[model samples]
Target: MLSDFLHEYFLKLSIIVAVFGGAFLGIGIGLVMRAGAALDGIEVLALYTLKRTSFTITEIILGINIIIFSFAALKFGIETSLYSVLTYFAATKTIDYVVEGIQAYTGVTIISAKSEEIKHQLVNNLGRGITVYKGERGFLPGKFDVSADCDIIYTVVMRLEMRKLKNLIYEIDSEAFVFANTIKEASGGIIKSRVKH
Candidate 1:
């Protein structure tokens, strides 16, 4: 009934329907998987294959999807298959966002002479906890024998807060060497800001 209605009214807008349908399907699947449930046999197969193979879950799923779509193209038409592929792509990305979370986390590392001030600012202004490692700097070809003690500052921040953190650090010390890595998952410590009553 739903398909008949959509086909009658949305034949001209099939692309939009396909993309949105795929996205909603992905969101549902992601939620189900997060709740420790499986909705598709392919996903179970992928999980089983994950333990025995070097392929990532995403790669495994994509490979399976390709095979399925190839058969679909042979049975249906190229246009239909292409639309299905687009839907699959949209669904895959939506699943990633749903599973990983909308707010992505990044691990940032800063090396600077003004580590103390940067640390203070990050803690007070950004409301972020940081870890400091004592390390030596100034190992150059000409100054191989010379070195100085320094503090390496590391912190985890949301992707949205990355720009603010970088700007704050650079504002304090323009030459501060700052780098960040995408964190797949993070827990513990002061990752969440304390709520005030």
Candidate 2:
């Protein structure tokens, strides 16, 4: 009877460990993502929205977890849903650490007929270096003839300053075409930033 009781207790303990262990695993993944400057799995979707959409990063993240939990409830059961929600919250604080910990940097690409003018402004005003690449223009309708001699202008700047840079560039030349991207890993050339903020 004692052995039987011990076996049942151990089984219960194992089940409890499994539940919390899954949560701990999720939290660990979140932290690693926070530290490593990259996202894993569902986090990738959040990262994509962060760059491509008007939505705030936090909103995107929360929305994703909500969807995940809702799906889990639908497919698995209420228990899975509850666990997912709990785990998601536990993992979320890692985002704050990740955002504050990682240095945010922007890569700017400009294609303009007035590349030289923009380049000058970028150099003199922004105090940053830029690279120019020979390229064709006008695959897009409005983009055509904007630059007779096509050159691609590229620069990297801190994320905090990206808005100001964009506004400045627009102020200089509204017709100038620009693409901004978040750089997770940047090396070579003049782009140098701390791996973490």
Candidate 3:
């Protein structure tokens, strides 16, 4: 009876370890990406090779994972391959979530013909501070007269505000041009905009 109890206890402990170990490995991989570094392991070899070769990272990772899975099946049988499959899925999904979160909070740049109006709306209406850059813009076949003074607006807003801000701009000028991308890290000069939550 005591031996059976011990056997069950060890089995439960082993299962717990396997599940959490997989999750921990996934978290560690996420941290490396956050740090703008690669996770130093067999899984990241594809990432490194792709960077060096200037090939697509997604394609390389997919190819390498398939090869690894096949090798695991041939050498260690299906059980080992199965465990690796679980770990690979968990790590990739977790890393993607973290990377997306990082991107959402990055700064935003706005290019619009109604630069002054947008600037006023952002600062006074939205209560968010912004910077302006002088520039010129022209569109269409043969109409290339530049603005005497155009403003390029830059601001950092929370991820949640992105949709609302875009809608606001569209309401004002449906023809407005806008683009946004993720930034890894930022500092100095109030990155957080003051918004009424």
Q: What is the C-alpha lDDT of each candidate?
A: 0.83, 0.70, 0.69
Model 1, 80-130: lDDT tens per residue? 888888777777778777777878799999999999999899888888889
Q: Write the residue-wise lDDT of candidate 2 on 45-104 in tens digits.
A: 777777888765545766787887887787899765776665555545455435544456
Q: Give the worst 10-residue stretch by lDDT in candidate 1.
A: 188-197
* Predicted structure with the largest TM-score when compared to the true one: 1
Worst 10 residues of 3 by lDDT: 54-63
Instruction: Enumerate clash totals for all models, in the order shown.
Output: 0, 1, 0
| Candidate achieving higher lDDT, 1 or 3 | 1
Candidate 2 deviant stretches above 4 angstroms: 1-102, 139-147, 192-197
Best by lDDT: 1
Per-candidate RMSD, Å? 6.0, 12.9, 8.8
In what order do the candidates fall by lDDT, top score first?
1, 2, 3
Q: Which of 2 and 3 is the better model by TM-score?
A: 3
Model 1 spans with C-alpha error above 4 angstroms:
1-15, 50-59, 71-79, 135-149, 194-197
lDDT of 3 by residue, 107-185 (tens): 6788888887898888876777788888777766586773445678888776778887898778887887788765545
TM-score of each: 0.71, 0.52, 0.56
